[model samples]
Target chain A: MHPLDEALQMQQQDPGLYTAATHPGYANAVGPFGGITAAQLLQAALLHPQRLGEPISQTVHFAAPVNEGEFVINAQPVRTNRSTQHWLIQASQDGHMVAMATAVFAKRRDTWSGVDATFPHNLPDPQSVAPMQWQKRPEFTNRYDLRYFDGVIPHELSGQERPHGQSSLWVRDEPPRPLDFAALASICDVFFPRIMIRRQRWVMIGTITLTSYFHADSALLTQVGSDYVLGVARAQVYRDGYFDQSAEVWSAKGDLLATTHQMVYFKD
Target chain B: MHPLDEALQMQQQDPGLYTAATHPGYANAVGPFGGITAAQLLQAALLHPQRLGEPISQTVHFAAPVNEGEFVINAQPVRTNRSTQHWLIQASQDGHMVAMATAVFAKRRDTWSGVDATFPHNLPDPQSVAPMQWQKRPEFTNRYDLRYFDGVIPHELSGQERPHGQSSLWVRDEPPRPLDFAALASICDVFFPRIMIRRQRWVMIGTITLTSYFHADSALLTQVGSDYVLGVARAQVYRDGYFDQSAEVWSAKGDLLATTHQMVYFKD
Candidate 1:
């Protein structure tokens, strides 16, 4: 069975209040390093909003240490205001709040507007580049349906290690569903645990903290025009085995859709 | 004349496209030590929306290079959708984008629906703590209407060292305005810069980056409470006197109004 299927099976009782996935990497045998990847848990949370799968804004707090193990994720809608909706997701290990998140999603609308700056008219369209076909083991793959528009990985990640910056790839909903702004709010932190250290690979030490702010249209499944600016991502500081970075995920052309910031534990 | 007047005076005739701000200190600043101080400029940005009197969600980028000088700020309202309004503020020096911000704001409403569980509780009442009185300063004195609710400065900027965790203050719109959401978005980067110092006394290093998100709500200025929860904030990582940190600012009633993550320069 697929790992996601197994995880779903464990949750067959369907305690829709939370996810019943047993992520392997976060098992106790691995110590703190074993904690379920934030990405895995975040994916589960984002999937919860598949019904209204529009992207929103999310802020996460690392309340305590998380060790790899069988974990449960609890998520539910908090407040549905006039223009925005808020959801709270908590990931627990052995009944402790390891990581917690708050997501704010905006409602759908037909129109949006912003400044029309000169987009790097020079940069090639993400489509013009060769498709990035990176396959993840079933354990990690179930979490994301990632598509790479910028075909080339940054040189720093290219085995050629240097204090260089990073790049952007087009990402979207997996299993294809319409999601709202709230969903986007949660995934913005998906890349931070892996920022910098491109040439060298490091299993996510863990997400010390992940947070994001959502802007633009809430409908991610549709509403294309690149009203958002080109995605500009970079790692500002990575030292002493810890890194802090931020990324601007632009709309297709060059409107600013969302901005994300993260601090990751680089256990090198 | 107000320091703000000193700052915004000349009103350079340039159409005003945002540009990046540069500073002196770094892993490699020719001068033994120099850096950017972002909180002040950030506070300045908060006043803009209030100036225009618009309510908006806030998304700020700490741009690649740290901003070092007195730059200009231009807030362009992107789309005033029926129910929502969006704007992008660009901070620039000569003609480069120093930092850009995109924010969303909603029309104020008196009531909304929320899960009872989401109702903020378990927070101290604002009346419980004595309002902190700040000694006047020639520069920042009246510029900001700062009311220290939870943690009091007790003393002037004598540069004394104390605790290490996050600090909280009650920040509201000055000059008697309706403390709009955009105003809070501006100051979100305010208190976070000083969390790094083992001692309170430190000089201006530049801020590498700042990313902020809007939270559920804090009581409007009228319902203002006491006891601010500095919430969870930390110097996630610091190297060569440069560090980045994230903070969640909560109101006395436990309402998480706004959260901020900033990369500021700190030195011994």
Candidate 2:
């Protein structure tokens, strides 16, 4: 099995309850990669027997970091409408809350459609861009292939103005797994902290909350199967002790796959 | 007292519980304005004695339409760190979930800061723009003084290609209320549905999930007190009965006050 799929694997204990363990391959400095945790939490909802349709929006709040080993997920369908459903999911370790999330799923119908936000232009093909080579990389970083167009990691704290904190990159699973909602959810958080790009120095930082809006349907994902997707992320403003990051993920063919935003806590 | 304040008023029942009524002044077709509900949900956290600081991010899901009259809000702080806190807020009517939200609050401190996203450029001052006049407006529309610079409502559904679904306007309370987090939260949703602007037609539409990242602090809000803030909203894509709207709220002085995004359900 692919590492991501293996890491996200779960056993259902009840209708909306499941148990899973953290994958050592995806370990970060803390518990596990936040994206993996996010994927696992969202997987609980996708696996629910009462799920109405594919997820269109999901928001996850990381209240506490997870520990190694087993954890429990409680996915509850708070409301189910004729064509839409809402879920409230929580992950806990030792009966203590570690993360919470809310998701929206719907049975989509044909509609008048168009894209108002344009895809990034003037970028080289993914195959031509050199892949990122990290020094002292985390286990999770090894799970994917990353190629940067801009905002590469600095060798040392520049201590100079690094204006326009933006990173655009092409990314795909290391073992080349087909694109899926779970994989897409995990990919949304792949960008390193914007602060690291902006200040060129590592600071104590963690994502407090992250929200992702998936635009691609099953057909779209299948079309992007086992291919690199372009991701662009930038920080709007860094104020006080919190900052917000806005990101867009696009398929190689220029289809917008997902848009995500998160609020991070930092201590300088 | 301001109608917005009156509409968001609540009576505390417990440490994490409060009761509030929907204000008719802000009623839409089926329920009170979603922005008001979002503000009330955030207010629940703001009012909690245990809350550590101001909110930096909030996500609210409209599980069901809230009816007129009283609703119960449960705002519990699931986790609290030294400088950051996480909250789970839910609004219910008759023991059924009507809305669910999560919030992150932090005690902001002075930090290295800058804005990467540019504010909209080249527009007449609010005083020069004519206020929007509605022939048949919702009650909530009357609560604001809106002056549009672009993407005004078309006299009729053109049925032609309405490209670039965007709206830029200057808006504030009709009677002019001072800017605050609650009022700012309400302002985030002031833009008429993007579909109405895109397709140039009235469609069956409702927001399923809305997320707002507050960028300005109390000090900044005070500086822009009662002034018309510029709001620019645009749709990224509309697909399969669902679409996403992205918006940025700016102070008259070009300060980005907040950025908001929402997924709306639409029927063609």
**Native-referenced DockQ of model 2:** 0.83
lDDT of 1 by residue, B94-137 (tens): 66544544444344333211111122345444445444454433
The superposed Cα distance between candidate 1 and the true structure at residue A117, in angstroms, equals 8.1
What TM-score, computed on C-alpha atoms, does each candidate reach? 0.41, 0.97
DockQ of each: 0.02, 0.83
lDDT of 2 by residue, B1-268 (tens): 8899898799999987999999999999789989899989999999999989788889999999898999999999998988878899999999999999998888889987778878878979889998886546789988999998899885555656577789999999978999999999989888988888877777889999999999898999999999999999999888888889989999978888999999999988
Tens digit of lDDT per residue, candidate 2, span A1-268?
9998998799999998999889999999887998998899899999999999899999999899899999999999999999999999999999999999999988888877778888888988889988886555788988989898799775455656587779999999998999999999999999988988888777778888999999998889999999999999999877877788988999989899999999888887
In model 2 chain A, where is the ten-residue run with the lowest total lDDT?
Answer: A152-161
B190: Cα error in model 2, Å: 1.0
Query: Where does model 1 exceed 4 Å of error?
Result: A1-16, A23-55, A62-70, A76-87, A106-112, A115-119, A125-163, A171-187, A190-205, A216-220, A224-231, A239-241, A253-255, B1-268
Pick the DockQ winner: 2
Interface RMSD of 1: 21.7
Interface C-alpha root-mean-square deviation, candidates in order: 21.7, 1.0
